[model samples]
Target chain A: MILQYLKLLKDKRIVLASSSPRRKEILEKLGWNLMIIPSEFEENLQWESFSHPGDYVVATARGKANEVTKRLEKCGEKPYLVIASDTCVSLETQVFGKPKDRHDAQRMLSLLSGKTHDVISGVSAMLSYDDGWHEIVFYEKTKVHFGRLAPEEISSYIDTGEPMDKAGGYGIQALGGTLIEGIEGDYYNVMGFPLHKFCSTMAPYFGRLVK
Target chain B: MILQYLKLLKDKRIVLASSSPRRKEILEKLGWNLMIIPSEFEENLQWESFSHPGDYVVATARGKANEVTKRLEKCGEKPYLVIASDTCVSLETQVFGKPKDRHDAQRMLSLLSGKTHDVISGVSAMLSYDDGWHEIVFYEKTKVHFGRLAPEEISSYIDTGEPMDKAGGYGIQALGGTLIEGIEGDYYNVMGFPLHKFCSTMAPYFGRLVK
Candidate 1:
């Protein structure tokens, strides 16, 4: 369904501006022979200034995308599209990134236990056109409801070390799927890529961008 | 989280009464040692008499689970649990199963294009206790919206051969993910298993069934 619209870019040089395995896997589903270019952009933005969690991720994502585009142009490799993304778990104004340690993971899970929290992944699709670059930025938020977790359950999950590198201390696609009671939106968004939203957003613009 | 409640059944003789790789993979996430026992139930139920799609699948699933339980007992397997399921795609009164051929797949895809339909999965969890068997039957319905699909898109996807064995003639986890505009319920339900609903339903009864 998606490949038909993207037939124009099937043979184009496409770069992903992040090294997230989940993102790579999601995009790979679109059958893009992606050249991974990890962004050098530092994520030290003051998130409090943003009006919503979506904006914060979009800013970070744009940072990586713009940096990668500049780096590619410097190397005389002008790609058709540079995809960048940033994800964070949020409860109101609080934003949670990858847990620093077991304790941090424990805290994040505890806060999320028996309650609903929002997972937002912001995407920046940078398409280089004839006149100039057309930038498309959007965010997807999935409301995840966690079943009540015992202290032991949290500790045991942390012991597996799955939470150590994942934002908000859980990989929802794996063991974390068990922890979830139900979800309200795109499952891939919680996996760090908003696949449904991304495809719908970028597909219509393919014709103009390709020409 | 689910594994913690399911530790009691970890070593028990558990049987999955279907040979579907998708169902097997989804259930395997709970960390159970499963025995694949394909049921010989002919699926010859009077599906037209059923009031709803859910009831039809539940009837088929129960038939499979009960048949498998009888067969396992005859072979001296004496399974602790036999899980069975049946899935179908429905739009209004219409129900669709696996496509018979490439043309059938094309016809189903065209009917589903630019429209929303229900993916219904019925699950039967049969647990053997001291006195008798505890049987639980439930169904999950997820509304899946497909983007408008062109004839070439349908033909191209049909060439991949993914639609042959999948209900609705599309595998939402693979190339079909692109066809979906959005979904409104458990994503796994569309994948042929209701993981979240299954865990929540079975977890509370684990203690009684184990003893």
Candidate 2:
């Protein structure tokens, strides 16, 4: 399904501007042979600057895509399709990014204990058009609920070191799935991509760019 | 962490009556050197035999475990522990098992489209003791919701032949994850085993049998 869309961009260059292995794996599954250009743009933008969390994530993704696009353009290379994505964990009003330490991870896990939260991932696809660049931004959200965790269970899981690098202090693809009670959105969004949306949105642009 | 518990079962013979590679893979991850004894018992039990889906599943799992246990006894191989599990998909009030054909798979997928349904898995663990055999049975329920799927999308996915062997016409661990909006319950249960319950319930028996 993904390869069909990639076939449309046969001759055009495609760049992925994120260092996430999960995103990279998903893209590879779609058979997109592309260059992995990690974004150098720092993600220290203030969350309060944007009205909605979705906007905040989209803006961050756009920033990363633009950074790679600028680098490519400076090299006298023709514009390519740059894809970047940002994901966050939200519990009601609070937004969680990757945890900084064990304590931070513990805090995130405690807040999510026996409750549901939303995982929102914003994606940005940018291409160099006739004049400058055209960009499209969208967000996908998945609701995940954790079962009540015993302190020992949480502490033991934390000792596994899986929570340190994940948003909301849990990696659902691993031991984190054991803690989950339910979810109401895209499972891939929790894994760092919204594949269905990615495929559907890119379908129309398939033959246009390569031809 | 799982290995720590497995150490307690080191002295006993354990049998897993399943041919599923996925289930064997999960057990291997837990460091269990289990004997694979696939059962030949027919899965023709009527869904209406039990009042609730959970009861029906528990009965089915018990049947599988007992079938294997009786065979082991006759062969003079009295294994200390025998584990069996059964999983099913329930949408609203309708129950679904493995698809009998492509049309059956499509029907199951269509019923689950854009709706939340329960994935119920019943697990049975039997231990042979001095007097006779002690058995424990329990069920785990995970609610899974499918994103609204276009008929064409369903047809395409069905064409992949992934749903034919899965209980719900979908396998959440593969491309089926793309079709799901989210799931509520033990992810392992949806995958066909309830690891947490299996570990916790067997912990006590480990001490008695190994020592």
Candidate 3:
């Protein structure tokens, strides 16, 4: 199905501006051999400043894309497109990034033990043009329902070290899967990238670029 | 989190009565060294005989489990438990198994495109008791909403040869992820196993067996 679209963009140089293995793996499903350049952007955005969690992640994703775009320009390497994304977990109004430490992970998991939370991922696609870059920003949200966790379960999960680098102190694709009762959206979004939305958004962009 | 439960079942023999790599991968997430013994049972159940799609799959799973359990007993090996599962795609009252060929896959995808269909997986766990075997059977349902797939896209997806071996003519965890708009239950259920439900069902049984 996507083979034709993949063939169209085969000659183009695509760059992913992040070091997340999950995100890279998600994008590679489109059959693009991506060039990875982890962005040096400082992701210290204030979550409270934005009214919506999606806006906060979009701002952070934009920061990563912009930083990587500038770096590529500095090196005189103009890639056809640059992709970046930021994922976060939110419980109502409060947003969570990666856990700072073990205690932080435990606190997040404890709070989310028997609740349903939203996993939001913001993506930025920076397309280079004749003069400058045209950036498209979007976000996808998935609701993840956690099974009631015992204190020992939380402690034991934290000990495995999977929660340290994931939002909401859990990775849905790993041992953390046992903790999730169900989900209500794109499963890939919870893994840090929204594969369906990303593919839909890029189809037209790639169509225009190829022409 | 599951390490303790896994430790309890360490010395016991566990069998998965299916040849599906996807199902095996889903179960291995619980840290079990499963023994594979694909059942010789013929899947010739009449979907019309069952009241619901879940019942139809549960019956099929029961057959597989019973056959594998008998085989193990004949070999003089009383395994701790035998896990078997059957998955199918249902739209309304109609059930779909694996497509017979590319055309059949295309037909299934066309009917499912832009519509929400149910992916139901029935699991049967046969536990050896002193006198005989106690059977535990349950089914999990997940609603999968697929994007409107173009004819070309459907043909291309079938070309990948992923749909022939999978129920619903698609594999949600692979190239088929692009075709899905969203899902509304345990993602693992769509992959032919329900991890959360399976874990919950086995916890109490494991407790009794270990004691």
- Say which candidate scores most in lDDT: 3
Supply the global lDDT for candidate 2. Answer: 0.78
Residues A1-211 of candidate 2: C-alpha lDDT, one tens digit per residue: 2333344464667788988888887666545677899999999987777788888888889889888888888997754678999988888888999999999988898899878888888999987677877888899887886777767667877887889888888887666665666566566788888776776666566546535
B-chain TM-score for every candidate: 0.95, 0.94, 0.96
The B-chain TM-score of model 1 reads 0.95
TM-score to true structure, per model: 0.91, 0.81, 0.96
RMSD values for the candidates in order, in angstroms, are: 2.5, 4.0, 1.6
Q: CA shift at A107, candidate 1, in angstroms?
A: 2.5
TM-score of chain A of each: 0.95, 0.92, 0.97
Q: Which lDDT values do the candidates have, in the order given?
A: 0.86, 0.78, 0.90
**Residue by residue across B100-134, what tens digits does model 2's lDDT show?**
99999989888888899998888888888888889
User: Candidate 1's residue-wise lDDT over B20-93, tens digit each?
Assistant: 99999888877788999999999877668899989999999999999998887788767788999999999877
Interface Cα RMSD for all candidates? 2.1, 4.1, 2.1
Off by over 4 Å in 2: A1-15, A26-35, A74-81, A127-133, A197-211, B1-15, B25-35, B74-81, B127-132, B195-211
- Tens-digit per-residue lDDT, A1-211, candidate 3: 2444767787789999999999988888777889999999999999999999999999999999999999999999999999999999999778999999999998999989889999999999999989999999999999999998988888878877899989889999988998999999999999999999988887777767546
Which one wins by lDDT: 1 or 2? Answer: 1
iRMS of candidate 2, one decimal?
4.1
Worst 10 residues of 2 chain B by lDDT: B1-10
